[model samples]
Target: MYKVRMRFSKKDFMIFISHLDLARVMERALRRADVPLCFTQGFNPHPKISFATALALGVSSDGEYVDIEIEEKIDLNILKEKINKELPEGIHIIQCQYIDVKSKPLMAVIEYSTYIVRCVLADDVNEDKLNALIKDFMKNKEIIIHKIVKKKNKTREKEINIRPFIRNLELLNKEDCNCIFKMTLATGSKGNLKPEVLIEQLKDRMKISILLDSIRVHRLGLYSIKDERLIEPLEIGR
Candidate 1:
């Protein structure tokens, strides 16, 4: 079997596609494109395709990663081209490469993601005030928030300190009431902090109001920490 890693983009209308549906879509597209897909061994066999992480609903990203095990080796360029042709609009393979099957899974190595968020500031708020608030927010040793977790089919809220998961946050641009910001936060198995969690913290801790309808999140890229540096998922094999 051959292990292949692919980086793809999901945006436009595809942002609404849930992670499970997205997987099904990819399986269908690969079948249509005639890719030689490996199947799991069981009574109900399915393609051996695994995503690095699940993007939040309504969030768009251009740096999603997936691992696929195929029956035989194929040219990376041809594989990308073939998959692109079969993919729906708003979804496209950006990069592809072969990796050793023994390498750690993408979900285990991917550590952080950078995001570009756009939202409308409340009528009473402005750039300077928001910036000041953010400055103070970052100085806290711990930013605690209530998180909902499900266990044994029971759901409950738990208190967690999300400050460590937040690597960086800053204001990028502000035009009239529209504002844009960038953030880098922890992701994957170690500690996953969704962008929405930080947004809610900002609102609650800072006592600020934002236009709910105007909030939008677009993931810029995903990265893994290696040798004390951040690198794209495709660089893992190298």
Candidate 2:
């Protein structure tokens, strides 16, 4: 048996697809690619594959990741070739290799993620002055806001202190009134900060009129948590 790490991207029309549907599609693609995947010995056998963070709906990514188990050792290059050949246009296999990751879980190791949010302002966007406010806000020890506690279809009223999850937010580049925001997301037991909530806080407090033609978030890299510190997930084993 072998443990394999496969990094792929979700883009194009596939971004509109839900994570569950993506999982199902990839499973079929692997089969077509002739991957010697390991399966649980149950009444119904299924490929042993796991996804880190399920991208929220309507988001595109160039750095999404998923891990799978294989029954036999295969050449990494061939595996990549076969998978890429079979994978649909939107999903592409960026990397694939065997690793000593038997005990580690992909979802558990993910500590922080980076995303690029595409937004257009409703007005001239006084970004020079607005950026200063964002910088100062990130420095504060405590920032509180009301959050919807999702129970099912309905979300309850609640107050969430964003200090725990948000590590940083920066405006990378802007063109023609469209702004690109790179944000780091929280992972593990500390929970995660949804992008919509952050945007809400910005609108309510920072007074930025961000209209979304599209919002794209990519899981840049996964990290392992240690003693309240962050480390790369691949450090578990090369």
Candidate 3:
């Protein structure tokens, strides 16, 4: 079996699409593009396509990934061109390459994800106070948040410390009422932290009155931990 790895971007209205729907869209696009995809042996066969991670709805990402198994190897450039023509707006294939099917899957190797968050502050908001709160939040050893967990069809509150998952956090820029922050958080199977959850905790701890709708989050990239350093997914085995 030949494996093809694709790097794509999700923006505009496509960010609102659920992961399941996105998978369907991709399968349809590949069929329309006449790409040679392999199918399972069953009464109802399906294209062998898989995504690295399911991006949250309403969040935009530049470093999305998808892997597909094909019956034969195809020219990367030609494959990208054909698929791009069939894909809809806001869903663009950035890169495509042949990879070893034995290589670790993208989701299994993902360790962290970086994001840019921009929060529009109110006119009365104090920048100094916000900055102080951020500093204090980072200095704390444990920032616990109660998460609702469902077990055996019953829901219960479990306190989870999210501090360990946050690798980096900084206020990148602030101009008037717009504050921009760059954050790196644990992701994938190890542990996953959403930018929205971090912001919510910050707002609550800082006593900031910013509305949830005022915050905009964009995922910058995803990385894998190698020798205590962050490396891109594609660079894992290379």
Candidate 4:
């Protein structure tokens, strides 16, 4: 039995680390932590770690995860303690559990996610305004955006629609006076949507601008759909 999984977060400040670099960091961390991890039997052996999905650079997450392979079955609680002692700030393993045969791993399991997009306001942005804008955007039968798909080459086409791409959507907050956004983003292995693409389009649609001010994006959770229903990653099905 050599399979395990972990979920953690990348806060605002540490969002600069790319997913690949983050993967390398975790590999080193595991080594330093001294867990008896299983490695692929090859000329150049490597840790059997698999990241479910990657968060784009400069973005934060609340529902990020990775799956790992260990040499043998061990106490998850003790393994967590040993790893936590070696993990750096902003990378805390919230849960460590045995792989369930009936359940899917993080990457394959995730179908959707929630995000909070924050920006500075030119004029006072309150709850009413936020709600109104998002409401208007949703009514759009087709929302066209410059889709950045492949890293090596970006495809530029004009006749695409975003309405079907989105699932449950909402806008949050207006009390603080600064522009804050709470939107549920469509994510998963099948078809994923990023909050930024929508935010950029929203900026165009509303004629709003985000200057030097930073937009803090937080991903709340990841859900999987099975039998036309949503399933929580860490939850045991009832």
> Judged by lDDT, which candidate is best?
1
Segments of candidate 4 deviating more than 4 angstroms: 101-105, 148-158, 207-213, 227-229, 236-238
Per residue, candidate 2 scores C-alpha lDDT tens digits across 1-238 of 8887787877888888888999999999999988988898989988999887778777776666778899888988988899889888989988775668555777867877777777777875666766886787678677798767888688799977887788779888877578788787786555878776676677667777776445455556556667866665545556
Expressed as tens digits, the lDDT of each residue in 1-238 for candidate 3 is 8888888999999999999999999999999999889998889998888888788999898988888889888889999999999999999999887878888888898889999998876654666777787899899899999999999999999999999999998888878788898999999999999998998988888776656788888988888887899987766543
**lDDT score at residue 155, model 2, on the 0-100 scale:** 77
lDDT of 1 by residue, 119-194 (tens): 8867757779989999999999999888799999999999999999998999999888787889999998889888
lDDT by residue (tens digit), candidate 4, 1-238 = 4667676778755688888888887888889988888788879988878876678778777777777878778888888877878777777777776775345556776777777787776656556767777788788888876544555566644555776767756665555556667775568667778887777777788665543346667786677767867665665321
User: How are the candidates ranked when ordered by lDDT, highest leading?
Assistant: 1, 3, 2, 4
Q: Against the true structure, what is every candidate's RMSD?
A: 1.8, 2.6, 1.7, 3.1
Pick the winner on lDDT between candidates 1 and 2. 1
- Clashing residue pairs in all predictions, respectively, total 0, 0, 0, 1
Ranking by TM-score: 3, 1, 2, 4
- Relative to the true structure, candidate 3 reaches a TM of 0.93
C-alpha TM-scores of all predictions: 0.92, 0.88, 0.93, 0.84
lDDT for each candidate structure:
0.90, 0.76, 0.88, 0.72
Report the candidate with higher TM-score, 1 versus 3.
Answer: 3
Residue-level lDDT for 227 in candidate 4? 82
Candidate 1, superposed: residue stretches over 4 Å from native: 124-126, 150-156
**Candidate number with the higher lDDT (2 or 4):** 2
